[model samples]
Target chain A: MTINAEDLHKVAHLARLSIEPEATERYTQALSSILSLVDEMQAVPTDGVQPMAHPMDATQRLRIDEVTETNQRETLQRLAPATEKGLYLVPRVVE
Target chain B: MQWEAVIGLEVHVQLATQSKIFSGSSIAFGAEPNTQANVIDLGMPGVLPVLNEKAVEMAIKFGLAVHAEIPERSVFERKNYFYPDLPKGYQTSQMAEPIVGLGYLDIPLEDGGIKRVRIHHAHLEEDAGKSLHEDFHGMTGVDLNRAGTPLLEIVSEPDMNSAREAVAYLKAIHAIVTYLGISDGNMAEGSLRCDANVSVRPKGQEKLGTRCEIKNVNSFRFVEKAINHEIQRQIELIEDGGRVIQQTRLYDPDLDETRAMRSKEEANDYRYFPCPDLLPVELDEAYIQHLKETLPELPEQKRQRFTEQLGLSAYDAGVLSSSRALAEYFDRVVELSGDAKLAANWVTGELSAQLNREGIEIEQAPVAPEQLAGLLKRLQDDTINGKAAKQVFAALWAGEGHTADEIIEAKGLKQVTDTGAIEAVIDEVLAANPAQVEQYRAAEPEKRGKMVGFFVGQVMKASKGTANPQAVNQLLAKKLEG
Candidate 1:
């Protein structure tokens, strides 16, 4: 029901965000208040109301399988920081 | 400690669709790195992904084959993660409502029995790109050619208890996908990939033990080895007064050991949510029936027909029916040649060996099924002996002649079935090899039976390998005895 600084830190780490030590208390307090608002909404829910997955409830439209895109590497690679041998280079990751 | 391992496999079969699952870019492998990535797959802003109809149909096809429930409504969810290969921070996958549900596969066991492995579900998703580490000089090179390719991740219940059973289950999955023509099921090019969940408990324990996931074991042999090694590691950890840590482990094939992947250990929280851009896919009974009509006879059906109707052994039936291409080729050969036994022998024997030696699939072989059936007919009618048939087959593969009769005529490989002509050659061999004849005659009774091999060899050589070996053996036995 309440968010602590440790939980805030874990969530920040999962989102790949580095939060300053001084700002943890502020973020934790803000998250806890938002949860209390959700708690209030949960308390006021009607007993027989059905949960809706989507508002329209329309099915998705599918496209037939075909290759429609052409090579845009020259235009796209210009936006990257580095490239070599037609490959985009990044920080080394081993799996 | 008498530990028993509980294992399950997660297989990702790349659907053989022409384009990306959600984009129009080509999913073709081995292209220039960034050539295949379009704006949408590259995670540009405000771009929505549209589902591919063929991929959805493929998912339904697989569900029908396994007798799984094809849900009227299936939804795709976004699994949030951070990886350099994944340009989008989250992967679009199916979590709660997968397309295929509650399937079962009957795997053939080593003892000639069938074991049913329960399937949890299978879902359709897009694949990530590849990271090349070797040539990047401390920076990873990313090839997005494989990105957005359609993959069906089939999850199984914890039904198998050993590596052998797990492999069997994986093989059954491979057979079905390849049979359905939905996937190529090639492991070397990463078409079919697998991850394993393994745990160990005391023999009579009712509750399950904690499990470790062995991730991305790509090959069949490696799947067996990885599961076995993980089982051993877990058992040893429990016996050594240590509790097994639930984490992901990587199997090192060179060392034959599994070690915890520290990076992936703490990163297990995949907060999944539905993608608002894509609506739930709804399929009606009419669409499901259409796909069901397009389905071919599956591997189990073909295997049963081969053994029961064609009078083949279970092993031969299984081998012939493992792939659609192989089974279709065998069927055509049998239809043309009118001899199922001979067709089975050649297709599984010489044709398979040649295909294996050339490192090609049966569909890509140099000789066609009709051509092979023609060559087989020659052998059936004693037009060419078995040895001559091999020569004819080799010639056919070399493109020397189009049909078996043409090659047999050109190469003079026809069998010497004429009794008078064969007798003339046998008489000549007996006259020229007077010393061997005296030795064969003076030998003891049992020794003489073995000694007749020399005269048969001489007659076959004297006839330039065109003599029927069986006729030569019979004549040699009679002539040597007299």
Candidate 2:
């Protein structure tokens, strides 16, 4: 994978970051260097090599399917930026 | 014009570990925002993530459940990105070397159809924080509470042909995850979320078309809508001689449309190198053997047992064994109820319906399995009629702790099983309806039924529905013959 100037801008935009104009070229070069290293792993020939997905060997942790939380509204509401009455308030969007 | 829709799902299941995958923070829900977050999750300087052993165990459990291969070693790579919700400005996840590989989920489609969607792989990843846009007028507030949550991103091969197939695949995966107890698989609480990778091919084509990934579809209904809408969009692009652009699109459930986030015409150079902070996770045979020993009876095996041993219908078994919790509930009810078929009926029919209607869960059900079994036994033994049984069931649902016998005694709900009492009532009805009796005895044999019904109703009224219908009908018929 190669990172061009346009690709850097798109990556930044998709990530919702405002990359400074000067930083875009710097990131493109850095990202390209990183991708080259990753591309090397592809050539290792994974023929008959199985991909690893998880580390643990355990399967199927059984839960009784019960509600474990309740009546902690006061505790949870403390994390909100703004609260009106019992509801969390945000900027209204639609009329 | 005939058209075929191709669909596949990318499910991110939050592993039900006691702590975050990388941090020591508790994975408890409904905690104060930022309270469950630790320095590692915040991605602060000088903080390093230590992988949770339980997460790896869960991933292996899932792999084993799906009959996938669990690699002896796997590596983690950094997914480079910058967002307010992403504390580290990068996500450490499995990319090239995922832990589980080459599993497939068998899905039952509509109309007795079956489709097996190949699973590409399931990788362990940490969840990012929630971005709450409502807090500010134009700014999105970031809550790191959900950040660092451990998730298993299960990606499926693009093999589905319709929305029904896609939903069925989602459901099947959901069942597997929940049954494994790796995830609660609750869409509303964000424990389980889906991203769909979809594309369309011409009626007959060897190669696949350009694919666009739809992001964070929160519900099963939304998955269906998002896939259908994306399919239409792709088909339109092809029909108009335009190409479908490969990009990440966000599904706006409120608008029922998918909007392009960005074009990924070229692949991302994530610069994904192995994390230097974390070593290659190596599992020894002894550890793997221990995890294997801890494995429970999986959903498929339980469903088979339900069918063969319990004599439950496939549909009934599927519904009961869909989640481990539901299966346990069925077992408990059977233990108490004594009749497997009746227990299956109550758990599937009444209990499930009530749970859905009341928006409660089986664990929170007011009627315990023992209580339900007791009520059913009363009905079976003719201790109470059906109507009284229903009344007792309502009392049970209301959390009345009275036993079935107590409820029956308190409400005078016992069936009038005394034949002598019922026979006396039948005689009185026969004397009162003499004309109808004569008509029944004369030329109209069919009119005899009406007379018998009249006598039975009188017996019921005299006994206040405590009289068993079978006993009443038998005594009335014998009196009519006389």
Candidate 3:
């Protein structure tokens, strides 16, 4: 249940987060402790216990289908870094 | 060595709900960018998402139509990914537990047989925004209008063997979704799309080859082409001593080839976990049973009824019932005209041809069902011949007149069934063509039977194509003999 520095670096890369090279060891130690806690939690025997998604014991609330939003392109575009022609502009992304 | 392609499809159809899946934003197409996007869709802070009821109902309807199991409780999970179109940086989808499960669809194969494709499961998810690749000052433009639109992702097992079966299976999905009225099924509008998983293995091999998933196959034809190309690529690679690598590929319709996606081809890990914002959706049996009861007649049942009750040929029935709009059009025409056979012929023949020519859907056809039935009524009562009916149909399509009777009166296209009028034209034809008449008399009786066609044409021509063909035949025979 130990996470090495390389594993932490890979995890950061996948999450698109940048961490300093010197900070990798500290983050790895922190992640390893978190994993050990998970290992401890999994050690408990709970056979036949149904896994639950939420502790509230409630269901999702439903909304009737309706158009409750209006044209707020100008207002929303003001929050973005860049915009043109009512579109949110971002760095070039291709798939 | 013969290699067989094993194909599976993950079809994503947009539910025709008024609002978004988890937001109250409008899901209308072709809207101005960001206009339909609300706070919830924009992933704004302090905003919570509530499930739209109509989306759940649509999922249930599709599940029942496909004979899928409706799990009383279904959970939504967050699929962690990074993309500009996804403002939330994670898409809320279903993972270990989906709403609909274990369905089977009976897709008709090209070899005149049915193949039962096992449905792995179908899940509901929110769509991402559109990333306009057009140059925006060396950047990409994002439109959030479609961000929260509801999509039902139907996943199938690896049961299809060839491109033909793949297309047939996709078509079956299209028909069922349209029939259930859950999706608009407009591929061009991005309402219906699919991702194809393709692999090729040696013949009789039990183990599967490494599969590559081809994304962005937006059309049915492209699905077939992409899968075939991927299959060929894998088989050729194996033959050349290269191992096939599992990856995600993009289908380039312009080049008709599948290329590996640029950045994420090495590996993709979407760490999925239950979404904390949305709770599990619990459905009762009563709601599911109500949907099953009120479900519209699906394509299979309609096709069967058309053949068994309406006495339509299987081919004709299939053509009519291929789409909901076309089938309902045929049904209304049959009801109004009271002739299923004739209605099937017109709907599958002339109307289909015209719609294809105009590149218009049946819902947008210029001539309504009542208008077509009115024209067929004139045809039924001998008010107009088949040729004249076409003329009336054209005129009606061109908005020349309202009804068939009006067009017949205006264009003088009524059939002349009266024996007296036909006989007069027959006399004139025989007198004007004396040289031919003499030759007809000198000819043998057996040869004379074919010779009468010339006189029939002349009589009908002299009557301006108004002479009834059967009456023209009889009168020409008697006068030529006498």
Candidate 4:
């Protein structure tokens, strides 16, 4: 499948990446070639083989159900751009 | 010209594990804003997600409870999306292979029949944080405490035909999870939530219509109302020559209307790929078997046992077995009273009515199971008739007495079953109402059937409503008829 400028713009918007109009064509071509490579990879025949989810076939490492973390609101809120009343504040998100 | 609604439900059940699914942070609700959020939950750099074993066990328990296929291996994938509440840009969720696969639940419908709702799959995922829109000036406050909390997203096949069926399906799921003790199943506290996919088609159409998903309906009542509103909206849209558009809609409970939250085109593609950080979850046969053996008697089995073995009606069984606490309470009542029918009635009728009026759960009832059983026992042994039993129940609810016998003794509410006392009252009633007695004797037997009730009432009134009604009827029949 070929990626168009409009599709690229939609993706960029969804990722919250503001792409300049002049750079749209270049990014589209680059991303489209990457997608084409993926298309070519998908075209390879591998009928009976199971799809690989991870690099190695292994089970998940289990952890005991315990509360090991303490309150770190002050420590974590130090990185926020804006905070008030122990909350990370952002521009209002309606819906 | 007839439109039929097709409905399916996706339920998000928050697991009751102590910590978040991927992090060791506390998953307890109502913690101060960011207190429960750790570095892992806040998506700090270099932090990896370690799976919680209890969460996986809970998910397996649910799969076993539903008799679903537990895959030998399940993989977690990153569902890419962007929102302020999601600290990480992508959420770790199972997509291609979920833990529970291809199960069905038999939900008891109102018409004394069970409707089997087919399950598509149930996957485990993490919840996003809350975006509090209030109490901030032009800014949203984010509480990351809920972030990384484990959630089991149960998807159902589009088998429901009405709002009633959808609600039944939700209730059944709620009962199952709560019974398993995996989740508290409290909708108001956001432990359990539902999203409904609804569409409409012509009455006999085999092909499905365009469906709109109503998202995050928290309450069962709201779910029913939202589906009804959406069905009406879709039918009207189709009837007016406007095609239904597939989109995500939000149910506005206040307005009782579903509004478009986002169109299909604006929705995210959610580029899903297996998470490299976490390994595939492989379950051995022994582990799955252990979970199956450890599973509790589920709602359907309990309901069937109540109906068939205990001889309770289907409705009573359904009501009693709707929640684990209620079923346990009913069982304790039956065990103590040794009367299954009476226990069923008292639990479903009097106790339920009191609980509803007080707006409390069965666990918070002022009257304990033994207390209720005591009252029921009084009713059974003719110690108190139904009316006196109700009075004793009211007294128990008001904290007037600890046991049924206490209230019965204190309020003089026990039935007077002594033949001599009843005969004296009957004689007084007969002598006081000479004209009525003469009329009863002169009246035909057919008319006397209706007339005899007056004497029974008078007898009961003379005895201050403590006389046994059947004994009163028998005595009145012997005296007035002969």
Candidate 5:
């Protein structure tokens, strides 16, 4: 559960975030604090306590397996920033 | 030396929610890069995370589908990471208290055996934005469109033995998710993805070997290939007296090999902690019971019913029940055709084959269930022969929505059931082919089949399949014998 400031800095760089150099120490402290809180769960003695995955015991509320949504080109296109003739245009994908 | 490959899958399915898991952003696909991204999705300051009730419902639906336990209280944990696509620099997911747990899915094996894959847990989480590396050159561009999309991380126990079981398990998860209307489960759209924790030990070994996690395997074929490649690599290392390192790896599908992404033993990138921004979501027992009541017949139950009630073969039942769309389609066909076995046959056989060939789905099929039933009824009633029905089926599949009777009537495809018309044609054929008839009488009796066949063809040409095949054969035989 121990994390180093240098490790935090490295992971930040690898993830391509523009983390300020001064923020690394702060992040290192905050992450350790959170992990320590997670560590507190070990003391709860989950020997017989079951791990939970969902909030309900219901199994598979399935649909009739049909496509309900279809042919909404105009509605979907409204969200696009740049579109021409039903094609989304980004900043020149190919040079 | 018998070596068993023990495999397990950790599949991540994006839940079908109207909004982002922790935000109100629209959960729409193929939208512009940042249009759907909201303040919470963008990880903007002071934007508190709000759990989408629909996402929770979907997780409950999935839990119920697998017969898993749903916890009354679950906490969202911040998986601390720095990824450009992860706008918050930490993913909000269930870590300690997941939503579902201790489930098992019974998968029917190819060899008439059954394997029960123990479900570890399925937790709800938010999706990260996409990295558009392919679109951008040199540097990867981030699209926050998918950020905050709800996802359910379904982890399975290491009970799988081979690549086949793993694929089956993945497919089962896919069907469950799609059936529950949880997510489209489209891997190509990144709605469904799999990360595998693969390891190798000698066959029947008690100790689990050093494991490596393979990330973001999108396709089922890739999951099998990546696991096989990784398994071979691990086995080779163990054989050579080398230790398999615990780390995260990436499957280079182009090279068909797995390369190390990071050393997990050294640094687990995820430093998980309960998120203070979101409180524990507690569901009451009554609500949970109501959800249970609403769950439809699961894939296994439907498959069993198709086999027992519909009298379909296990294979056909499995195919039909594989997806909600397919099963419903089959049911509609049966309702229309009023023949369960025949409906199962046409839906699984001809309809499925056509859909696969066109890379479409049952929902997208041009031929409606009523149209298919109508066509089959035509064949049943001798209004059109089987050969002519195929042509009608093809035309109907190509957007021609004419009824079977109408198509047969329009194309003059009716089977010739009239004996008088067929007899006239048979007489003309016998008169025109006296040489062949004489030769047939003079030659061996076997040669008579050829003469009769010629007469039958002439009758068919004259009557244009309107002549009943039984009638044609009977009339030809009587004349030839005389």
Candidate 6:
């Protein structure tokens, strides 16, 4: 589960984060320590126990299906880095 | 030397819920960009997602319709990816335990046989928003109105061996969702879409070949063509001594070919983990039972009823029961006319023809079911012959009259069943064509049967197509013989 520098750069790229070259080694070590902690949990044996998704074992609270949203495009689009024709604009995405 | 294509479909059905799956934002289509997006949909800080109960109900209905296992507990996980359309850096989806468990759908094939496509599972997820590339001056425009829309992604086992079976399976899913009232199942509106995983292996090989997925095929025809194109591409690649690479491909419907979008090596590893913001969905026995009881008669059950109880052919039953609206229309017609076969014929034949011609759906038909049944009733009672019934139908379709009797009466198209009146028309037709009559009398008996149709036509023409054809045939036979 430990991430090396090369894999960390790839992960950072996938996350669309640009990490400085000096910070790559620091990130790799920090992420690998987190993985080591998760690895410690993996070593514990609880074969029959179900995997826990939430700490409190609470069921999902349901909401009735209703349209409570109002038009806020003008307000939201203003927060974007760029916008045109009421849409949030970004660099061209081909696929 | 023969290659067989193995196809599996992953269909994303937008649940017909009013709001987004986890947010209270509207899921209505055709909204202005980002108008329907609320704070939660926009991935603002401190916003939490609460699952929509209606969406869960819809997923349960689909699971039950396909005879799938509905687990009491399902967890929502974060599928992490980076796309501008996904304002949330990750999508909320079911990864480990989906709401719907294993199930199988028995799709009726074109050759009157059924093929059972095993379901791998179905998971509930929120949809990503749209990215408008056109008219953006080389930049991309993002619309978040579709973001966080509820979706039920149904995945199938690789059981379909041909394009035809894949299309049938897709169609069956379409019909089921539409019948369940869970989704509109409109491909044009993208309420229903499919991604096909295709591979080719040598015939009788136990191991499957490398699979490539064709993404976001919107229509059933395109699904078929895309799969065929992908299969051919794989087969050709293998035949040329090149191994097929696993990749995600896009089907260019305009080009009718599939091109690689990205290789599998570059595919995103959606680091999935349970979302701590949303709790696990736990269903009680009572809730599941209530959903089961409220379920409507599914397509297969209705098709069976039409065939066994109503004495309809399998094909006719399939056609009539394909959609709930159509089946209801047929049922109303049958109830009014008390003739299942006639109702089946008219519903599938003339009504369908006219609807196709006018480019309208059955729900938008100009003629109502009762009016059509009224026309069929006249034909049954000899108030109007078939030809006159057709004329009445045309008039009804044109909105000339509201009732079949009104149209028939206005056009004077009632069948001439009176013995005396028909006898006069027959006599006049015989006298008007004496030379033909003499020729008929002098002809052989076998020839007389053929010649009798000419007289019947002449008599019908004289009667303005209102004469009962069977009665005209019998009377014409006796008179021409004498």
TM-score (all chains, Cα) for each model: 0.92, 0.79, 0.92, 0.95, 0.79, 0.96
Residues B1-482, candidate 6, lDDT per residue (tens digit)? 99999999999999999899998888888977888898899899998898999999999999999999999999999998878899988999998999999999988887778899999999999999999889688899999889999999999999999999999999899999999999999899999999999999999999999999999799989999999999999999999999998888999999999998855454568889999999999998899999999999988999899989999988898888888999999999999999999999999999999999989999999999999998999989889888888889999999999999999889999888887899999999999999999999899877777888789899999999999888888888888777
- Per-residue error (Å), model 5, residue B368: 0.7
Report every candidate's CA lDDT.
0.90, 0.79, 0.90, 0.92, 0.78, 0.91
Error of 2 at B407 (Å): 1.8
**Model 3 error, position B61 (Å):** 1.0
- For model 3, how does the per-residue alpha-carbon lDDT over A1-95 read when each residue is reduced to its tens digit? 99887788778887898999898888989889999999999999989997788778999989999988888888878889999889999999876
lDDT for each residue of candidate 3 in B364-458, tens digit (9 for 90 to 100): 99899999999999999998888888889999989999888899999998999999988888999999999999999999998998888888778
Reference-based lDDT, residue B243, model 5: 91
**What's the ranking of the predictions by TM-score, best on top?**
6, 4, 3, 1, 5, 2
Top-scoring candidate (TM-score)? 6
Candidate 6's error at B310, in angstroms?
1.0
What residue pairs clash in candidate 3, if any at all? Answer: none
Candidate ordering by DockQ (highest first): 4, 6, 3, 1, 2, 5
What's model 6's lDDT at B430?
A: 94
Chain B TM-score, one value per candidate, order as shown:
0.93, 0.88, 0.92, 0.96, 0.90, 0.96
Report the C-alpha lDDT of model 1 over B1-482, residue by residue, as the tens digit: 68889998899999999999999999887787889999888888899999999999999999999989998989898888898888998889999899999989887776666789999999999998888888677899987888889999999999999999999889889999998989989899999999999999999898889999998788999999999999998888889999987888888888988888876634768888888878989999999999999999998899899999999888888889878889999999999999999999999999999999999998789999999999999998999999899999999998999999999999888999888888889989999989998998898887887788888888988887899998888777777766
How would you encode candidate 2's per-residue C-alpha lDDT over A31-79 as one tens digit per residue?
9989999999878989996544335443322223222323344665576
TM-score of chain A of each: 0.83, 0.72, 0.92, 0.89, 0.63, 0.82
On the 0 to 100 scale, the lDDT of residue B230 in model 6 is: 93
- Report how far residue A57 has shifted in candidate 4, in Å: 4.2
Candidate 1 vs candidate 3: the TM-score winner is 3
Error of 4 at B422 (Å): 1.4
Model 4 residue pairs with clashes: none
DockQ of 6: 0.81
